[model samples]
Target: MNAGRPELSGTFGAVSSTHWLSSAAAMSVLERGGNAFDAAAAAGFVLQVVEPHFNGLGGDVPIVSYSAATQSVQVVCGQGPMPQAATIERFRSLGLEHIPGSGLLPAVVPGAFGAWMRMLAEHGTLPLADVLDHAIGYAENGFPLLAGAADAIEVLAPLFETEWTESGRVYLPDGRPPKAGALFRTPALATTYKRLLREAATAGGGREAQIAAAERAFYQGFVAEAIDSFVSSTAVLDATGRHHKGLLTGQDMADWRATVESPSSLSYRGLTVHKPGPWSQSPVFLQQLALLEGFDLHGMGLDSAEYIHTVTECAKLAFADREAWYGDPDHSDVPLDVLLSPAYTAARRALVEDKAAEVLRPGSPEGRTPFIPEQSAVDWPVADGSWMSQLANGLPTVVKATAARNDTCTIVVADRFGNLVAAVPSGGWLKSSPVVPGLGLSLGTRGQTMTLQEGHANSVGPGRRPRTTLSPSLVTKDGKPFMAFGTPGGDRQDQWTLGFFLAAVDFGLGLQAATETLAFHTDHFSASFTPHESRPKVLAVERNCDPEVIEELRSRGHDVEPAAEYSLGKVCAVAVDEKAGLLRAAASPRGRQTYAACR
Candidate 1:
């Protein structure tokens, strides 16, 4: 089955991590005759106000942009380096316990600012302040409470019980979380936005000016002083004798920038696929895709026994590589040249055993590098819901806790100028960071992904970035723009993305249909070398997948579990058919206020 270039459906397109404000900001940009880059920036800014847990201004951002004129796609690593003061010795000497979330210690340089500024500076035609007016207005004046935001705040009120340690203000007013549709205001946040606008206007009035304004305001001016004061008061670094370089410095703020890296590629199923350099999880994803492609995925059929088995086994194989060596490549050596080789992918995929548990780690081309990061052990036991019935028990089971949290938001935009942009901002979990008052903006606390232990691949170190999972991709097939997409849920991000790509291309679903389907992923790689993987083989799926499918998987000895709907992954995407000029978009329905639109 071949689909021709999609027809032009009147032209504007966008998708976001959540459904609520994504469409709002995208439409605003479209109405202004702005390009995809502008629309994406607008949407990302709007998201900072709409969904804080899933994203905020404090987190890091990475993007992949495509231009029809150039017929080329570029990737941006919107990750900030570890503070200069960060070191392995500091972590060990603390002797207090796990890296404390007390304040700036867990800080990573904020990248969303640099990404947005870069997009506007390089591709956007409109003024940065003009593009941000809508979001700034919304933040200052406040927007209606999204049912998702309200409900999430209610559930996580304990985190806001006290003022953010960095900024002495309560996250929730009067210790009460609001309900959906409530008028929530952030006067301090509004003030910050106004100051940024003022500085941008008074300065040279270019991308550099806008970025300078943000850095000075957030990292060195008012925001920096607040954070530095709080950290000093807390004595967080007393044991370590230093603080992260950019934590409260004019230099780090002035130097804040998103790195534009050279493109990297991997072969999957005879397709030459490229991903951003090591800043994101694109490497791990390429590994999984290559391993799965060797199995004839389209032939396995949707949710068929072979399909599930093949994908799961491939995940196990690929994840081994991920857990062992995947992290920010700038500070650590990743066997990328070896790992993505055709021979390596082929060997990893060949480990699938038909009609057998395949319970042992595959032996071949295994990583000899000795920097495997160790975590807690996993216990995978086989018990029966039906005393060895044909189907796995399918009972509700708690997914194991990883240091993971789903706090990223994404936006995809396409403009009439033939410019496409996909932006992913991670680290809205708000650990050790504070929200800018008037801006209603929160910075990223991304440094949390680092291990407190030394010599580990992800160990904390100055100028070294943490292993990031946010991968905003812009890809084409046979010389035409086809897809722009990303998701929340760290570690499993690319795994979830693989499902989305398969549904759209192999299953012939539209943007919405592809997004509505069931999804699943594995923690097998994150938990390496476990004696047994009692972890469920059948990932969380929609009830519609047919009970018989579960029965068959259980019959085959998979630990099947019924997961809360959409609990497995959060995904969003936007794609266009260049020949037809038709635009399409979708957001994860399983997520709160996750909405999308095309105009």
Candidate 2:
């Protein structure tokens, strides 16, 4: 095992998250006799407060979990659908071809709050107030600001001050970004949560009723009224070079709620891996596994050039399929079964060659109509025009931006009762949209993932869920829960998690060692963000990887770019050894904020 960071072990329970405070909050819940669901919910709420630049109350979350009592796994689909007025015609009327990356026009019904509450009410032992205590405390009292969050505030300070005054009020206390490690508080957000609790208290019923009441307050009560009033009253400038009012309304929020669904999974090498359905880019991970099943990964060596090349190529192919076929299954007829079939995987695997393929190649599943939107140049302009300009020009920019505004948070919790949950909560970054007045939250800009082209599976339409990139991973071996792992890279979430999984299972590395290993990702497929740019045959590897390996990849027709050692991914994971009654958890050191705690 790698000696850098030891894997945390405990018999009682463990929690790992993208932030230390959130991890500590989860551990506190577990110590207080809460199960994995409760701990996860606590950590998730705390993450919203601490990692405000990554997620917020207006964000969406997708969770894959295992219940010890039922001995079954399920997915919590928290991604909200497009507003009733949000359609291709509306966007076209605004003279836009694609949804702007940052604006009210891209806002969706907030989904994370509903999803977290549902998880708590269905599987947790504690009440909504208990699970929300950590978040409320942090927001009310104050917490040390992280360097990443601070940097984000600094970068967007100009925009915040000039265009997004509400955001400036929350992020910049004295007309400036708070320095790293400085104590910071968002009293507005705290007040918002307190108001929800007060509304819940008025329900005068059981814990479930209280939770339901809180949900109603958020979706249909004061919170909804505030959002509707604000959006209706304002028109903000967005990436489309125009000011537009939001499409969301109180009726939209009242009509939507998170739902439970089956996970998309595939068995491989004695392990069964599970991910959220096509609505997310998760199934791409399973599809990658299917293609890799035919390879001898062990003999190739973990850090070998051949191994990296093979994995990169396979990711390109799978992600191409994601762009073409994967979408909200409720809105599109995704041929998931045919895509996951062994025969189909074999044919796809056969396309992987020693040399890199420099094109988008999505497999044609029999009898299924595939929809690949025409790749168009992204016209959305970044506020600063820094790294985004390079990306817009088809040049390789570092993945640091993926860690900043477009990033998400990952949580893996395992309690003493054997309940396990892996969730990726994301969407409402400070850069995505202006902060909602009074609520101190922003609506999600996930609608940027939808296409304007009519009839496309991921086309923007009323009530259609955008194909999100937030995918969490859960694994099982021999009919028992084995691991819950995830990371925070928009299109690279599954790519990084797959590398960590293979390192542990195929290379026999421990959780910590596996996560700390060199990370890399390919931009060969269409990106999930606005402009949907694709850099054919481009591969980015961390500087920690051997220079020889990088050179070898370039020699093989790969446009290899060197990234900062710790700029790749912030992956966190937890594993259970039921036979030994031990739980092991690990967090990536890349971002300096992720943490793993066990006791």
Candidate 3:
């Protein structure tokens, strides 16, 4: 396959992102002598502005980065916990079997701002104002509106006018959705950033103190106060088909702070792949790698029926385990050690037969019984508008005929000093929840990913982080930074990125070629989003896939569904050539918005 765009390479730095403006902003930071962390922080803020339909300041992000100065890879956990008042009993009392997908009830403590600030203060060379300047400018002045954002506004216009008035004020200026490619501005969002910057400047000391002050302002100061007042006082309509006030308060925001922790890692084909803990669905990628390692992926050939079946089966098994065992380790007893052990993979690998399996089978790790939450078919009122599109469609920005919402984005950057960062910024879409009054962002509906069932690893609880779908990937060759890569596909994130990795490592394809390779995923397990739907024995392959391969998969008991060409994944990646002293980057051409820059 010919990659529409070339794989970018340079010795100075390289940046890849789902949007051109974000990639350009990060690259500009690199040109200004900022490190990978600095560039990534700049890009994160810019993504919140430019891709409002995909992510926002009130969302969450999980970052995986390798710092040259520390010579270690670490995870910045930006996913916030449920409010102190949130509880499974509380939800059950509301006659809800599952967390509502949208509205204030599912809102968690907004975590993106704190996580970005933490990264900048700890690992970046630039100050808070410099890092946030690009986003502030884009939001204050005008930028071309994206077709997806316009579509989102159009879908939610009725709701905005009737219920989410705060959103109405921002997206439906003049009482209508903006046209695609028209100049659109979010002055309120720009004002929010400006206020934060002004507060940061009031701190007594240098760069670090200012960054700390900004973080405090967001979590403990005006931002928190506004969110508290809005959530506590407003009786808003949600997916439950009823009006309710949220449980989150100003204290919830104050109690939570983004934390830095060691990433879980596993070795595969001479590369050490690192991902966040079980709280995220990331380890499923490594688990798939472990199962696939037992097969001769090279012999099957890329995009072959044999290749697709094997990989799809492996993904089903891994994701089944994600539903059974993955959660916040701080809140539950997750046997991650046993789940990723070679013995576990060896046992689970046997479940992958020549044909597709129709049942959701999760293995018992350490002889402990697996608990699968009862799947419910909740007709979540995700109006036929932006909310439905964001949760039901496969990707955040693109229209796809899939059931899962991949409502997030990827950011990868590598600097000349061997520092690398990969982060997935997600949640708080313009349609997910009502925009907080006085703030230009919506609260994250991440709590919707948590189940209401008890005894499940990912059951909702006070102060517990939901088992999230957001995942960022980092890889090291010989214990040194090698590649940072990921995508924005709710449940399909690991599946899409896994295919790219196999194409690159097993088939010897370049970054761009590997990214543009045919994409596919199985809806064989429960989705992380609301309604928790699943389709056993189904495989969705891109239309670009060979017809013979599609038939071959169907013959093997797979209910194959064909998707639009270049619609499955929006992957972005950055790599370092240690021996050659070069940095490489690639962005998928799937959505026509993703871009890569290096020089």
Clashes by residue pair, model 2: none
Q: Tens digit of lDDT per residue, candidate 1, span 1-599?
A: 11122322456554454546666777777788777877788778777766654566666778788877677777777787777767767755645234433245556667777777776777776677767787678777878866655655564354344434323253476557776788776556656667777777666656666756665666567655554454345433211223332243434545557777665665444344557766456776677777776666777787776677667667766666655566678778777777778887767666677643444353334546445454433222333321111001111111224222344677777666667777777664433344443344554555555666666666778777877777766666665566777776666677777787777766777776676666766555442111212353434444546688777766766666666555555567777777777777777666455666666
lDDT per residue (tens digit) for residues 36-155 in model 2: 999999999998898887889999999999999989999999999999999899989878877777779888999999999888888989878889899999999999997768877876
- lDDT per model vs. reference: 0.60, 0.86, 0.88
Q: What is the lDDT of candidate 2?
A: 0.86
Candidate 1, position 488, lDDT: 67
Worst 10 residues of 2 by lDDT: 390-399
> What would you estimate as the lDDT of candidate 1?
0.60
If candidate 2 were superposed on the true structure by all CA atoms, what would the RMSD be?
A: 2.6
- For model 2 the local lDDT of residue 235 reads 92
Ranking by lDDT: 3, 2, 1
Task: Return the TM-score for candidate 2, rounded to 2 decimals.
Answer: 0.96
RMSD of 3: 1.9
If both were scored by TM-score, which would come out higher, candidate 1 or candidate 3? Answer: 3
Quote model 1's TM-score: 0.84
In angstroms, the error of model 3 at 180 is 0.5
Order of models, best TM-score first:
3, 2, 1
User: Highest lDDT: which candidate?
Assistant: 3
